[model samples]
Target: MSNATNPTAEDAPPTTDEESVSVGTWLTVFGGVLGAFIAVLNIHITNASLKDIQGALSATLEEGSFISTAYLTAEVVIIPVTGWLAMVFGLRPYMLFNTVVFALTTLLCASAWSLESMLVFRTLAGLAGGTLIPLSFMLILTLLPPSKQAIGMGMFALTATQAPSIGPTLGGYLTEAFGWQSVFYLQIVPTGIMFLILFQGLKKTKPQLELLKNGDWFGILSMAVGLGAMIIVLEEGNRKDWLESDFILNGTLLAVTCLITFVVIELKRKDPFINLRLLARRNFLLSNLVGIILGLGLYGSVFIMPMFLAQIHGFNAMQIGLVMMWIGLPQLIVVPIVLRLMPHIDIRILLAFGAFIFGLSCLLNIHMTADYGHDHLIWPNIIRGLGMPFIMVPLNVIATAGLDKEDVGSASGLFNVLRNLGGAVGIAVLATFLSLRQQYHSSHIVENVSAYNPFTMERLQGFANHFGNLGADPILAQEQALRAIDAIARRESFIMAYNDCFYFMGAAFIVSLGFIALMKKPG
Candidate 1:
């Protein structure tokens, strides 16, 4: 009998497959991780250097905020297209192109002479950077077995999560010692090293363009327009005083129209950009709900906390960064343990417990005082660190649990988009809420204290006496007393507003628990 036809030959005893890291695999992993780290690092680094960037560029606060929003917008806009792009271009070529683009963009950003030029370069960098995270995840899935995937994913998450927390610290030091441009220069070293590694070790993969033979160009365009418009409106809305300004009103109308049209078109399109049909699966739908709420909690509190530290607590960027280290270190330690235990635990229970713990952490913020120290945030941050691994990893698994191999990419894109959109919405809403609350509280305080009130007069007189004791002229003393009273009122107003923000964040987390509880339990 022929060897191929012989049953014994077909059923020959399997030899042990020794798992050793090939040079290529090591290069790919290192290059991919480094790229992802730099991308994530750049996002937060700018936060510490925003003041320097604004001063250097002679840009307004709103304009400086766009430095971040623009990059994020570009990143989100390109994310859904990654799967299609990979299919069209093949993985190695796509990665190569992205690396080159990212590197070149980093150069431009470092040398940019104007705000407009910097924003343009940032947008390009964001477009290239956006592909790294999802592609890295895909590469890990493709190469590693299911058992080993979590550990690999944990490492990737470490780069992603830890980089942002550490970024501000490094950026603050760099900006203080060198200049604002140093943050961009930091990207060059990693990008160059990654590019060299990728060039030598990456191999071309089979193109999967046949999957998109029935391409939904119209659906893609509609969704892009809709999502882009919505993001723009959200990001710019507070800056322009949402609905009060004609620009904001017009943008809102356009965003609403595009979104409604996109939703209708997607339901009918053969292959939608987001694939709304995935939501028909109960697990996918509920997982997205969980993602959105988790995002709201994560971004809203982080956004508020930094501002509070800088404005109220008189902390510098470095101090804020140091405080955030408390949050990052615990997460790094817990993630590995979580990955090891995930397979043995009931994910549904873990997710619910995590959501509850995260909610509790947000509640802790409600107790923050003007005199609060770094220790005040430590326990709550640790709870946050523990809660995140449970919420993030399981939700990712659950979101794609029912999807076929072919559907995984599209589902991941949509899920990530929702999470980002949730963050954008959370930040915008929180900022507006804080602004309005501050104004309302300030007005209430001012109204309650009048010239006729004994308390108000007593406080003013005490301030005037203190100013006089400082050797100020009578006129200057009175002026200093009035200024001091105003400052005190503003501080009190902000404190009240901060309390409201924390409560809102806590409630948001609790509401998310219901969604988490509803996620379909895996067999």
Candidate 2:
């Protein structure tokens, strides 16, 4: 039986029974899932390999972070344009083109010898990868009935929500066992298979040409520049010392001006790149607000945890990855259960409960010490795993619950763009916070020690003696003791910074709980 949504004039009449799905249908699902996974994974897998990439490319810490910031910055800029792009090119063709482009760029990234070359290709890859998330949702809405969308969306969430965490896990092992480049190479095989299946199994449908002709091209361009600039400022501001640098101050001002202008133009234009009318819906607007907060907490925590494990806990890349698997695995189990219970339960209550658990997880991190090990961090991650499905799946359902079919694409596009933007902001804010707190704590620790202080003298003498016993000269032992004291100060400073980050996350989660309370049940 054929499973076509649109029947042309020359098409054969349907049989008495509703059209049964063909083998091609399952093929399309697999293809779509694979494509979605590749797109999502690319955004995050490089995270664990950042240190290796930096060393290999001879890049500064700030320059190396661009590998992530550049990709996400490009992604947010493109996401809002997906609805208009789809209307111009159609779903099947657009997805196929994107898949091909992504594959080609991945190969380029793998072979890139210089940091500059890799950054260029990574941005290109991101432009293509950006469309997959929203388009995945659009396709699911088109193919499945509302009743079954929960399960299908749950499966998609496994890729979308879980990939950020899982990427580091897979990437850690690959980076440690092979090299950072291996992560890009691993995507080629899966994405190639997806391209073949999608090209074969999916039918093409052209978008309305009238809609394309009416789109505001200027608005789209402005929005892209505005968002891209804003993300750059956010990601790089701390490294440049924020407003102290002329570059950051000017970039921030330009971003704000352009973004505000884009909003005004879009609101006034007849056919904006993103349909602002969808935001008029209460649930749609509120759910997206929650999505932003969710992105902040989720990505912020994920971004910081690797630093904690590797720097403070002294774990290797592979060990960091294995520890993170404990978080991702439970989400897969929890998503299915949440899908089954969603219909019977109030989504707001579920979200609140999830926020509470998530906040509790953050609170756990606040108590972490310099002496804490892998076992000390495991339970909090597990609680985080349990809290995630409730926040993610339910909020998603609530976001699009009341939208008409025509609005689905725009709503999905807007929601995804905001989500990505939230993550970018979260990472930027946390990085800046971490840096400031580290310096503050380090200064405080240093001020508390003096040559005349008995405890300080005793510790320094003890360290000098320990070094002397290892066959060092007296002067060398004294210098070594100073170095040891400095190392201890830096370690304590990092611990304080991490604690501050966790406390901020907990507060964000509490704020989310308030927002969740405002969410009304789906009609």
Candidate 3:
């Protein structure tokens, strides 16, 4: 057997004689990963074109923002419960139904008549897309043995981790070349292909009718209300002014109350909607802790970099995408190499090295200046591309190392839920941090700009003179210079603030080096 298909030494790599994993198994795994890709890709793609979509729908920025927000809110709510859902409706039938519904919703989004209609279509689309993520994760573990699990997971992680990176770039080009609706339409070809592949490949298995018959309705409702409210608060918290907005304050309260109740109910229920008991295992908890931290770094960094370019350096969606590709394109090279090396190396060593490199990459970005461009980001990004697969792929495989086959599906769903929620929290907290720091830095810079300082007076005079030289009236030139000074001050403050944020992100992963040590090696 090829190294890629072989299991770990500890796993006593399964033989083809014992239970062969055929080519078709891997093929179906690929199909499922593609579904996961499109699900997440939609989140970033729609986000990239949200402004244009707003103009098309004639909605305000806040209303248009819900197009992406609603989809994700639905997605987070659905991810953890999907394992039970897959059990309720057999995996193959459930997946096929979701693919069809997701495709249909994409079409609805393309033809949406108004903002409200788009929100409905997008939310429904999320309901379907959310299933694809955990479903893909569940399929890989059940289909492949530990020895060969790396190959399957490497492929899945590549898509799940890298697809978000590619979405903004892909969406920008598609929307620019075609139109805003093209972002929704672009999924049609991929969805059609995914449907045909899974439909032909997956055999129908009888579902546990009992699981469906005794479905935990209360668990589902509380999970939805809790996860849904939390996602909304994260998505809109900054806009609503967090604690100051009654809507945000009340939503936060409800989210906390419902989520705590969800844990309590799931723990007491004999057959719960989510398998909360799985978290009691040490390896599972430790690995998930790492996953949550990785999620913050992964999604949080993806968000902050493009924002820096777009906000500070004036890069457009396409340009930002091009710059962001440095972080993603290298993963293609790294993931395959890591797959080959994984079985030979101590998985812990690989995880530690990856976490180290990943943290280094974040710290490297702390050197950003006002003039830093695409060239400035390459090495830091290259380090990140290489480091991430080390963490993401290994974590997935090693976390489930000791679980029974039946427990894998439930574990995968809850694992993914943490990462998704972590990403949401990371982005929200980072955004808030950026805003608060910018205000602080801007005020501090202004404090040093008084007339008592010769450098400050000289700089202000130079700006006025420069504007005056550009053929503006003296009064207009004076106003323009003052505005220019303020703008420059704010921009510098942002750069400093972003630098601090990168350092904080790096520290999280650096801390995860300790997390790597906490895990007991797979037996």
Cα-based lDDT for every prediction = 0.75, 0.80, 0.85
Pick the winner on lDDT between candidates 1 and 3: 3
Point out where model 3 deviates above 4 Å.
Answer: 1-19
lDDT of 1 by residue, 1-523 (tens): 0001111111112223335434556456667777777777878887789888888889999889888877887788777766667655576778778988988897888788999998999889889988876666555555444555555566666665576567777888888889988888888888889888877666545554555666666666766676777788888998888899898788778778877887787787665555667778888888888878877877676678788888888888888887776667787778877777788888777778778888888888887777776878778777877787777777666675544545655665677778778888988899899999999999999997778999999999999999999999889999999999899999989988987888887888788878877777864
User: What's the C-alpha lDDT at position 50 in model 1?
Assistant: 85
Superposition error at 26 for model 2 (Å): 5.7
lDDT of 3 by residue, 362-460 (tens): 999897999899888878988898898998888887888877756766787789889898899999999999999889998999999788989888998
Candidate 2, 199-253: lDDT as tens digits: 7766766655665555687788789889989999988898899999999999999
All candidates: CA RMSD (Å): 5.7, 3.9, 4.5
Give RMSD (Å) of candidate 1 vs. truth.
Answer: 5.7
TM-score of 3: 0.95
Instruction: Return the lDDT, model 1, position 8.
Output: 11
**Positional deviation of residue 446's Cα in model 3 after best superposition, in angstroms:** 0.9
Name model 2 segments beyond 4 Å from true.
1-30, 54-62, 207-212
lDDT score at residue 251, model 2, on the 0-100 scale: 90
Q: After superposing candidate 1 on the true structure, give the runs of residues whose Cα lies further than 4 Å from its correct spot.
A: 1-33, 196-201, 206-214, 451-454
